[model samples]
Target chain A: MFLALDVGGANIKASVFKADDAFALRSAKLHYPLWIRGVDGLPKAIEQAVALLGCDLKGASGVALTMTAELSDVFRDKKEGVDKVLRKAEEALGSFKVVTNDGSLLDPDEAVDRYMDVAAANWWCVGWLASLFERDCLVVDVGSTTTTITPVVEGKVAAKGLNDVEKMALGEIVYVGALRTPISSVASIVPVNGLWCRTSSEYFANVGDVNLVLGLLREEEYDVATPDGRGKSVEECHERLSRVVCGDRNMLRPLQTRLVARFVYEKVVEKVCEGVLQVLSRLASEGRYPEVGFAAGLGDFIALDAVERAGLRGVLLRDLLGRDNSIALTSASLALYLAYKTGVDVGRWISSLR
Target chain B: MFLALDVGGANIKASVFKADDAFALRSAKLHYPLWIRGVDGLPKAIEQAVALLGCDLKGASGVALTMTAELSDVFRDKKEGVDKVLRKAEEALGSFKVVTNDGSLLDPDEAVDRYMDVAAANWWCVGWLASLFERDCLVVDVGSTTTTITPVVEGKVAAKGLNDVEKMALGEIVYVGALRTPISSVASIVPVNGLWCRTSSEYFANVGDVNLVLGLLREEEYDVATPDGRGKSVEECHERLSRVVCGDRNMLRPLQTRLVARFVYEKVVEKVCEGVLQVLSRLASEGRYPEVGFAAGLGDFIALDAVERAGLRGVLLRDLLGRDNSIALTSASLALYLAYKTGVDVGRWISSLR
Candidate 1:
């Protein structure tokens, strides 16, 4: 049995898994504004998350970790952020392993020397796990503020870009996602009253509001705060979406607001589809194409819809991992990959836990 | 003998023009960080600008006003911004006629009653002025933070959309300019080290840095503060542009930084060109195409380049208004339009000035 943790800017996710076969036994996710709370709260948050998962860390064989928290604004720079996160992880889980951008696992000491490799490298573990299922496949993980599109080939992670910056350049990482993305960043012009109205760049609304208004996201899944600090009611969502075009709910009818939401949804899907095509085209140029796509993250539906729109085959991570385990897919994958790569006796550890 | 003021979010421009034939006499533009200084600085800034033009506002026959300052964040909302600007203009220039979105002039009281018409309506004055020269033309004004592309037909402003939001919806306005526009807002991917890299979404640099590095803008014309609060030297511009890809001067060579700047410049030009094409396509569908493009604002060179790239006849605003007067072209246009529309005896006013 191994504990895996995925720490992000906005939330922290943890999972306990039978690492040998990548079977997640339990998982928990907690929202923690690391940027506001600072790195000091990370350890407590991790403890609470692990407690919710009912995991006995001392009895675990080892811990695996991947983080995007280093990119959060809490730290002055990414290097400082990485170092601080590594120190906190050490305090919480001694002698743990870190998943890196190069699809390798490193111990804490080596992680510090190769800090860039481990910084915001959670997607790499997901890509590696996806490759294990199919030799030729794409891993599409749409998180709160970004989307990662990684191509796998011959049961190996095949990516031209190593880091977020490089991946963004390669069109493999889109700076748009399900919940926290500002709607102004998605589509500057939206359809309003049968005309395309330019969205106010004031960040009065975000993608969460769009999805909420469109009924694509459940009320409970609306985990983030609204841009206007309003409730997550459909009426409030409409009001927020209306403000994207500098209109209030009173000025725009509910139907008009719904149209605005639809436009934003379509634009985001189009963006993801464009990224998918770009990655596939790059692979095709190398005489390879992803035969299937694995969709993960909170915005998995978006990825599934984009895949179908792009005329590609796709499978939801929940369908593959089971619904209860899907929420911690990235963390589970990190643990499983670390065990496989490091030759950890995860099966024996699972039996001991029983 | 008439003074015109065009106040925007970033700068305040003023000009003195002859009422007859709309000939410009003198003009001045003063960079004022209205968003930072707040509306409280407006009176002093306007006085300084008028003083720089060596004009006597008290002796003027009348003052014409148009403003985008209402959209600045200094005010709680557009209404308050407009009302405050009107009050300031009344205090500074006595009884002034304000330009409205309908291309007509109104007194201060009527302007308040129709505040929406007066809010950010400076573009209307430019479009009206452009229509005077060529009935079928496109006025492409690239300001510091936004671009306005207004279509004229048969010597009339034939805009499908009114106001900034409406024009933006019509593709007559693009939220990109030659300066002060964030570089990340231009393109997510930029060329780096002979490969594409995703630029850091942080506001580490802006279009001003891009143009500064490329020599398109003179050092003095880099009027706004940089994203990193650095100077506007070529070396500093390189450093700022490098930060767009999350690098500094130490990490990237000067040549590499230049490539980044060039990429951003191309992307901005492409955006403006796309807006121009969209507007032209709409006109073409209506059996009318702009025969020429009138380029104005601080980014006239960019507009000229885009117009040529779009295969449209281009004329520089400086050519029409003269080099010295072009700095305040919008203000001069407002003054001329007010005189033309109100039938003000500008020849008498010029004689009085003499």
Candidate 2:
């Protein structure tokens, strides 16, 4: 069995996949404010995830890693962040292979030299895994703070952008997602009380509250803290959304706040659709159109809606990988790729460990 | 003999005005990062402004204060911020009257009780001053981080919104401003190499660099540091703007970067124009249309452009108040109002001090 880790700015996820059946044996996720607290808290976060997964590094054949944590403000730059993460990962797991955007794995030493390729490359691993299943498809992963749109063609990842900056320029990365994104970032002007009102730019509410009020987010998926430091009740969500228009629950009717939430939700859908069309148009100009869209992430409903709105066939990763595996698909994909590359046989590996 | 102080989030300004001329005898502006460093730096900043204006507070008849510094993140909330500012101002100048959004002055004790009115009411002072010149006109004051659009009708400040949140909801406040505003906040898509490229959401460059490149901001006006912690030279500005499109000076031609800067400038203009039209439409519905626009602040050129583009007559505060006084018009207005209210002939008051 191989253990894979996906370290993001806001979360840390781990998965252990057994090569015999190509299935995840265990998985765990933890939320940590890596940006605010810095990388000093990362070691404890990793330990918690490992304990939750009940995994021992001594029993695993090898470790695979992909990370987007370098984009956090904890480090001065991406290079420093990459170096710290690699150093900590080595200390925790002994040694590991890092998955790069180029679809290749590098040892810890080599990964430091090629930090740009390894930084924020988790989405590439997911897209690569999707390409193995269906060629000529678009992978749309909408997470809490961002959305990644990658196209796979002829059983290979066909993305021209390698880093977040390049992907943003190429329309492969949209800085909008289903949660954690401030509502004002979606649209400055929103309809409220029968007229157009400019949304307060304060962090009064985020897209998570919008989705929570709309019933698009399950209680389990509402894992992050509310922007207003309030409870996660529907009434609380309504109150927060009302504050977006500088109104309180008493000042605005529940229906009015719901209308505001619907407007924000539609704006997010429109933004994702715009990203999809941009990527699709770039591919179509080369006479290559995605046959379908593979949706993942906690905000998969947004991707599903965006795919339909963009006139593309939609496929949910949850349907293919099951709900539990879908939640950790990025790390699981890294594990599967590492297992194949290392030619590890989980049945015999477990027998040896026993 | 009256010294007026306008403490803002980014700068502290002071002016001495005489009642007979209604023109400032002396004025000074000092840049201070109040938000980041907090209220602990306010005393030194005020002292610097007072020295620059060559004023002796002990000799002055009284002091008048208007502030937007309470909106800064230095304090926990508006109340705390207001109390701190009031305390500092009282410590520096003994006692003073604060201008409020209600177009009235309050003592320090009363000001603390009505903190919301005192919290960012500098714009109200400007609008009240403008109403003295024209009964029906829109006052547009664009600062480093936010824009305030207030309308005056029938010689009264006829603003429907009171605080920043309410003003934001009423379209009387637009968060997009001339300087310090991130370029990505203006437009997500920009032209690069003759193709549409989404600007990086990273704080690579702000509107200051954009204006600097476009020649709208002079070297002296480029007082704040660039977001990248780089130099303020023209070449450096071009490099920062290039990063907004995920390109550097080496990757992008100077012409390409110039194109990006022009796009951002136009977007800022469009946002200010939208605010002006919204406020005008609201007034028109009530059978009151502003025939002229009063432009103030360091970003007066943007307001001038926005007003002309919106098909309204424009009046420059510099043309009316002269160049030196225009820069500190907010404080000068407060001094003028205090002199009129107290019937203090500052010309004789200064002579009596001698």
Model 1 regions more than 4 Å off: A1-354, B19-23, B342-354
RMSD of candidate 2 to true structure, Å? 19.4
TM-score of predicted chain B, candidate 2: 0.93
- Estimate the TM-score of every prediction: 0.51, 0.51
Off by over 4 Å in 2: A344-354, B1-354
User: Which DockQ-derived CAPRI band holds candidate 1?
Assistant: incorrect
lDDT of 1 by residue, B1-354 (tens): 778999888888998876455555677788888878877778888899899889788778778888888887778988898899889877777788888887778898999989998887887777777766777898888877888888889978877777778877677889999888998898898655435579888989999888888788988888887887878899998898888888887887766676566557767876787677667656654556566988887888888877765557999977767654555677977777666666865444434432
lDDT of 1 at A316: 88
**Cα lDDT for residue B100, model 2?**
88
Clashing pairs in 1: A169-B198, B135-B155
lDDT of 2 by residue, A112-198 (tens): 998998999888777777876677898888888889988898978888788999888777888998779999999898655425789
DockQ of each: 0.02, 0.01
lDDT of model 1, residue B62: 75
